[model samples]
Target: MNRYAVIDIGGKQLRVEPGRFYDVRHFTSLQEISRSDVNIKVSINRVLLICHGSEISIGQPWLNDAVVKGRLLHPCFGKKIVIQKIHSKKKKRRSFGYREQLTRFVVDSICLNGRDLKDS
Candidate 1:
């Protein structure tokens, strides 16, 4: 049996599992923290939903007692995407590109109510 959880961070909902890494939007609160290979973890209280094998719990916006724990792995920028803007018959055009700042995290555990599922 496998367990999974849906967590909300930076205005997005992400499906996460234990022992896996995910690239997400950078959090301003964590940016100032010195990067090190330590236990720099965060407990997110905004869990949207949780599923433990056969049992499932869905929250009304967010679960009050549910929490998702994660560790900061790294901070990086996503691949640059080019944007081209042109005006019809105006001969005015602009080309630019930008990369999104992102953060990587490794899910540590998912606690439902008061119990935590074992991290694999």
Candidate 2:
């Protein structure tokens, strides 16, 4: 079985595994930082749970001295969702759509117990 972690970001919980990319809610400042640098290291301290090999650690809210490292893969908008409205009397219709911007990240490592292991 592969190791994985459950992390909280922007009040949303996500299941993340190393070496995989995920599209998450966008942070405005992240775009500014990424503009200067193509890739940057991101450390998330809101790790709710970590499962490594046979070891498992759960936090009351968040574990102390524990973090998850990731690489920023860039920012992009997700698929659009459309909405439509119609007026029966006028026989008129309108349609619009919205797309959520997301930041892409690849979970690099999950650190616990004062040790680090790079994802394979």
Candidate 3:
């Protein structure tokens, strides 16, 4: 049997396992984050993974009984959306398209002391 760790991201819990991938929901849309007047840096780099017995730090390679590792692959796009505006009196129309941003990740491995943390 295999063990996994639970991680919290975007107000949700994710079950992380070695050699597996998980798609987390995006907190902010691409258009919203990109067009903000205020300058902000979107930190979508790494996540913390902890298991029942031990914890894993993202920077260093460390795994406990239930440890896992993952990396941010890329930002995925959602379905195409269109916004339209029309004026009856002037007979004018406007249209716009948009797509949401989604992220992808791949589990590296659960290791401790430079060794795989197999189920005990």
Per-residue CA lDDT of model 1 for 1-120, tens digit only, reads 779999888888899999898988856567554555545788888889998888799999888899988888767679999999999899999999999878888988899868888634
lDDT of 2 by residue, 18-73 (tens): 88989988553454544456567788888899887777889899888788898887
Query: Where does candidate 2 stray beyond 4 Å?
Result: 28-36, 87-92, 117-120
Distance from true position, residue 107, model 3, in Å?
Answer: 1.1
Candidate 2: what lDDT? Answer: 0.81
Model 1: ten consecutive residues of lowest lDDT = 30-39
**Global lDDT of each model?**
0.83, 0.81, 0.55
Determine the backbone clash count of candidate 2. Answer: 0
- Highest-lDDT candidate: 1
lDDT, candidate 3, 48-114, per-residue tens: 4544346434423222333345565555677888999999899999999988666666676655445
Per-residue error (Å), model 3, residue 49: 8.5
Show the colliding residue pairs in model 1: none
Q: Distance (Å) between predicted and true CA of 90, model 1?
A: 2.2
What local lDDT score does residue 3 receive in model 1, on the 0 to 100 scale?
94
Q: Which window of ten consecutive residues has the lowest lDDT sum in model 2?
A: 26-35
